[model samples]
Target chain A: MFDIRSSIINQKKYKVFYAIIPFLALFIALFIGGVLIFFAGINPWKAYNYMLQSIFGNIRLFSEVFTHFVPLVFCALSFAVAYKGGFFNVGGEGQLYFGALTATLAGVYIQGLPAFIHIPLVLLTGFIGGAFWCWIAGILKIKLGADEILNTIMLSYLAILLINFVVMYFLKPANSYISQSEKIAKSAYFPKLIPHTQINLGVILSLLTVIIIYYFLYRSPYGYQIRAIGENSDAANYAGMNILKGTMTVIIISGGLAGLAGASMLMGTQYRLTPAFSPGYGFEGIGAAVMARNNPWGIILTAFLFALLRVGAGAMQRGVGVPLPISWTIEGIIMILITGSEYLSNKFSTNLIGGRA
Target chain B: MKKSKVFLRVFVLAFAILMIFSTLAMTAPLKIAIILPHAITSEGWTKSGFDGLMKAKEDFDIETSYQENVSEGELKGALRGYIAEGYDLIIVHEMGYNDPTLEVAEESPDTMFAITYGFKAADNVAVTSGTNWQANSLAGAVAGLMTKSNKVGFIISNDSPVAHNFLNAGFIYGAKRINPKAEVITTFVGSWSDVVKGKELAKAMIKQGVDVIYSQCGVVNRAVIEVCEEAGIWAIGAVEDMSYVAPQTVIANALAPTEYLVYGVIKEMVEGTLKGGRVVKGIKDGAEEITFNPLLKDKLPENGEEKIMKLRQEIVDGDITLEQMQEELNKQNIKF
Candidate 1:
């Protein structure tokens, strides 16, 4: 209920309240995270000191955070776009694997081409692969009245198993132990920006995508149609919009965004596909999407926080022997507090204005 | 313009705080670190490595830290993080860490590294390359002597030359040495943890009249042993003492002590004799050997224990060598 519609109470005051929610949630969650460290018999101050130093002390270490952030951004956008269009496309994990599989095939099997040609072509294949996989769930939604949330979640497992089988049985090189595909072509690589660091063109691509997606959703007439469908599908239907076509389009775009995430990861960091290659990046993006309130620009910030927490988890382990789960605990707390605060603030504002109270 | 000035002030404060903590982190002495690919509580390969790390920490009286359950995707970054923290020796405790270790080692020439199950090496990297085949060879000899059906089975973790030379070819070669009529059957499970596939493979081998089986897959080893127990047959355990899993079924337990590999690297580091190449140790160095299960001592087929023990001694005395076994593998064209 504390969505964009909350602006009906008082737009300027609501803006200030929404803006403060993330920082307030983060601060409270980190405080709780310190309590956890205290209970675990670790010096909470020392644990936090190490975490902060590892995250922001040096340039390369800081840049490494973006390595995880890039894939998350794509996945967050994937969820955000779909959520805005009145769909819960929770199949980002499957869509990502589908993209990575197709991208791997294209990158490995295709003949020599210029970097310019091959890169875009590989990315296109990834998008098509993810979009097509998600389209199955979308079609089921409109035609068979299937719940996409259940379908996408289950499809993730199936997608992972199928990709593993294909790679293990077919694409694995001789004299190898792990289930992984052969390395992709060099031409398809997202060019690295720093020596011995994973900072690459993927970062630029993600930023560009943020601005583009933001503009499309807020500025374009088509984006308004998608938002309208989410607000009231029957009203959208009465508005003479083809609800089926509009819904399917949003789902496809959502899946394509996640597919781009897979492609970026493949092109940026991992040059090969392996079983469970994502490390739950797709699932994490849902947290980012929800925490960012499905805003394209806000998703970037939330994704960065997710990346920092993961990196900080390693720092805590390395610096003070804090277990890896504490950072994850902090992330879970942030999501919960953000949701709770948003709800509470919405109710407070409604009560103040005597509009919905 | 006013907001920009405030942002600049906060940035400077944050940077200053970061510098102090980073410098504080740099004061550890002769630190050794281990990077484990799986959870230590898994009670398998990763657990053995952690035990060795602790043993090294105690024996050498040196500072040691470890990071376990690190995935392959994050391996490069994890390795770099340790190097940045100035760990002198980073023991990468998995075969999957091979490629990433090579890359990180190339970047940091001063830092020493020991990669368990790793293949390639560089200027500062020494790999834990021991001969598990020696133990497999001896187990093959014992299985050959014990089997009445003249069929022995080896359920390997995967199809590779390492698995072949270490777990299969040496197995077949030693079986024929003791019983020329012994037919050694080998099958690949394509995974170290696939219980169902391992179970199916064990059943199929049992159907083929194999009364004695050697299974090298990790969790699948338990599955195979249980199947053998249900069928009232014999099994050979690998890597560690697995007799308690099924006392009657596991007749002989073959151990290619992976802990020794870890201990050996720490020893070399202390002795200032660590070199960048394959460190091949086996029965002679007490890194590989076989232990017979006492629960099945009555089923030892009279002097079966002696014959296997003498063969192990011959291996230790250098009268029998892994090179000879490697040649046998070549002659048999049994490269997986």
Candidate 2:
């Protein structure tokens, strides 16, 4: 009745449970938000209606939601790529900033190119910039046995400061009235997808990136080896897999993804280098990646969920006269619930399968 | 005998002119230097200061040099560098640089120091600024005359006395003068850049029947204008002309031209009347002025121009004073 291979896991039951998890998480999150809404002296139904209507009812606002969605998905993909190879890349923020810096430099300095060449050139440099940041952490982790988490966290702040210091002096516009760089060349800007909305080529690129990463993680031999090492490094090593190369490649890809996020933001709406450009998209990416269970396709949905919270935050303020921090409460509840559920599920699986109970 | 005497007199006059020219060459033009917090173009605030420095150079014929992007931490060092360079008049053309400016000024007491947008002063330091009171008072006067609802609103970033004394008090005084029953509903949105909060607060005021509102929160000014545009109401803009931002909604703009403050301080220095005190000037000194929306020019009530011109004249003539408004506010228990 309890054969190890056959009954170790009930596939059908697990599939059903897995399918229900997101809905359950969503329900629980909304419930917590509802309770807070009640305390804020606003009707929960009206508040939720306002949140949804603010984004969906207006085409312009809906496009803005995608603008937020692009960065979240890229960041999530960045985290997911490294995490799939048994590495935790926490420096997406730094990498993203570095990418933005390089993109801005290219956009502002590298002149005399047509739109086609310039956009790609700027975006490529951004990816390289991010990859360069990631490569240092990867080398430190693999070659020198350093903690990537700490290295990335520290380096992220360095990247932000580096951009600020550079822009404050050498890169500053001749007649700039603010502490920011000159606007990037018009040709280097991302093509607009909608006339009035902020939706740009970044959204299309993000979707394509998701598909490409999904294939890279599932189809290629390198992908299999990376996942194998993630599952059991010793086992993979005994099977003649190159753990060093696999891990490094994962990190570079992760960094590139994050860098793309930075480049997109710069080329899309911002058009220049400013310190306040990123609103913790780097950290939020990690959250989205974890929420998606590192699944490439699931990341899109998770990113949209977070975007919903952000885009709706303003409407919540405008509609019910509730403070914007109400969104933060819902975000906190969702994070805790997702983390708690994952912890409980792992233990449940361990007891059931590991113990053969 | 007459020809010889004439030649002698001409020779003596030529020699005297040569001596005067050589003596003038020995002295140099006034060496004035300015330190700004930003580059001179694009943004309006720092540009005004830079423009003032340029104008001072042209008007007073002073030698001028400038350093931009000198942060607060670097302000003392920058000021010291100017002192070492033997600049006659040194100016920190930005707000919130008082402490370091005064510290550097005290170290070199003989050197004159000037800072913009502060109330502090010392023997070697002069605080030159445009008064926020008059610009806002003028906006209030317009709102009071224009509002059909008898309720004007004043939305600010925070509860600073600087704002309460100048923006709120001055606004209330002007509005009450036009319509004594007019209520000034003031709200603080906590931060200047919180556009969402700005719009929501503006909407809340609109719900309370505030037809004409004054927005003084820097970037949130756009949000307030947007709310007014959405509600088809009137809004008075601050700091810069915002008719371009919301053509249909922005009725008038309160201006803070820093060039006036800069030019005035430099003139004082050149005239040897540069006293160490807060020299806050408005309207008359060209520091602040209330400008009507050119786009909505026809929307103005008949005699609105005459009425505004008279108020401005009174303000310029010292008949309508900020001190009087401050006393009025104090009388009404409106201190911080």
Candidate 3:
């Protein structure tokens, strides 16, 4: 049997190789993207330059990119924590919706509270709501041997339906015509960091979250046990680690992080909950987490890149008359290339080491 | 080793050069961008707006482009790009774009921006929305007059102000106008284009004794119509003369002609008659109107055609204002 676990964790050379994998993957993806441009009746080089200029050419565009990066970081961190404990938490999107929904409710209902108390309380509601949602999935998995992926996906749909029901039946504002929750109180809002831009303190909080999660993952004792369980459940069991407990803890933490992401949208950006408030941040978080291989710092970098691409794609659509769907195509191609590069690098390393042996 | 290094360096350099050239080639003339909330292929509701822009482009003689499936985070970048490229007008559809549109408008004061919904206006921003509720009320009144079962159904998408104020409220109010005893059963699918759910809800309503359905849920209207057709019941259409979408079952339609609004705005812009503020287009402005199916035209109630035509004239003549219409409906205990 292949010693995959040892190869992944114990090898210093493999660590260095994996460290460069993401960049190599991106480089290769861009090259493949060039060919796609050629087929689209556009020169690949010019398309990429336009894309780059749209993202990083000006302060306004850069701000737009980073603004998107804020929520993505939170979402990625959410997934990274669950992934670290060998649990696939796909309910991030639903958890995010519940988080925003609960936060919005708290913000609207709880009045007369000071800004400091209201803001933290609203955000805490989101964290608790998301964690509670994830805990359900974890509990079901542990108690009933239910598949986390299927249950989480179903829960996400349920969460969406539940939010719709709440918004329509309870949270809708007076005289409002739509199915949206009432706007949160002014005191509950996240303060803007920039004068004219939508960029808020949430970006700073997300970055802080990354640092905190990184510390919790690598520098803390609990992190060690989680990693150990993730590496091998049988070995972890032999070593006196409770696999069920670790999975539950990680899922809750993951869901909490994702919920915080949703809260950030309510507090920092939207200031209200609508049916379409989230633009699939949960799915994007998965991409970001996978791209970074669940590393906290790596997730930040990947999330930023994803944000840059998203922001730049918008610019491309506006400036160059390129359709928005083309951007999705570019993203899809990049993801494929990234996966291909990883496979290629692994094969190359195997051959080189085999020859040496 | 030197040869391999040289090859790699040259390849990288060539790739960089290609990237630079591709970026330059993408620059276009007279860039006009639109940011839409949903995918273009989603049909009817969003596509109609895109179609209106495409129609406007024919007369305006400008380069038009649109971004579909745009979320709040992407709106700023899309707007910034158009502004940077010296685009004259950037039209954003969907209410969610309100805050982002305001932010982008403030950021780029030079760019002329237009938003489809909402009354909030800035110096550089122009707000345009129709009296959708007025049209929807008309359709509801028609449903009230036409339904034989005394039970009418309404399929709503989301419980947004846009839907409730214009479509749902108007529908209920209209139904009650002609028949006070009529029961209006309302169900919301929670999505703008969920045909499956829409069909399910409509079927459920029909099963509960609803004979006529006023679909106020955009693309999901098709599903409601489908259910109506299958059940062989009467259904009212809104937003466009969606009577054509399900001709056999659709009895009438309340039209919110977005193209008319887009054309009117562009024409004003061309004539230098456009200004910054909200423009509320309604029946009086020929923005909202009702279209009855040809099959049902002669079959309407004895004086129904004359009554509706007289009401249209009264609305156009300003003898019956939207406020007056609301008051009249309110006297009837209709909440539209």
Best by lDDT: 1
Tens digits of per-residue lDDT for model 1, A144-218? 999999999988888877887788778877767545688899999998888667789999999999999998888
What digit string (tens of lDDT, one per residue) describes model 1 on residues B213-266?
Answer: 998876788899999999999999888899999988899988876778888898
Of candidates 3 and 1, the better by TM-score: 3
**Highest-scoring model, TM-score:** 3
- Pitting candidate 1 against candidate 3, the one with the higher DockQ is 3
TM-score of chain A of 1: 0.95
Question: Which 10-residue span in candidate 2 chain A carries the lowest summed lDDT?
Answer: A314-323
Worst 10 residues of 2 chain B by lDDT: B69-78
Residue-level lDDT of model 2, residues A36-66, one tens digit each, is 8899888988989877876687676677677
Interface RMSD of each: 2.6, 19.8, 2.6
Q: Give residue B165's lDDT in candidate 1 (0 to 100).
A: 56
lDDT of 3 at A134: 84
What tens digits encode model 2's per-residue C-alpha lDDT throughout B102-132?
7568878889999888767898899987777
| i-RMSD of model 1 (Å, 1 decimal) | 2.6
Error of 2 at A118 (Å): 1.4
Query: How large is the C-alpha RMSD of every model relative to the true structure?
Result: 7.4, 24.1, 7.9
TM-score per candidate for chain A alone: 0.95, 0.95, 0.90
- Summing lDDT over every window of 10 consecutive residues in candidate 1 chain B, give the lowest-scoring window: B158-167
Off by over 4 Å in 3: A1-45, A105-125, A165-200, A336-357, B1-32, B61-63, B107-109, B179-181, B243-247, B295-304, B317-336
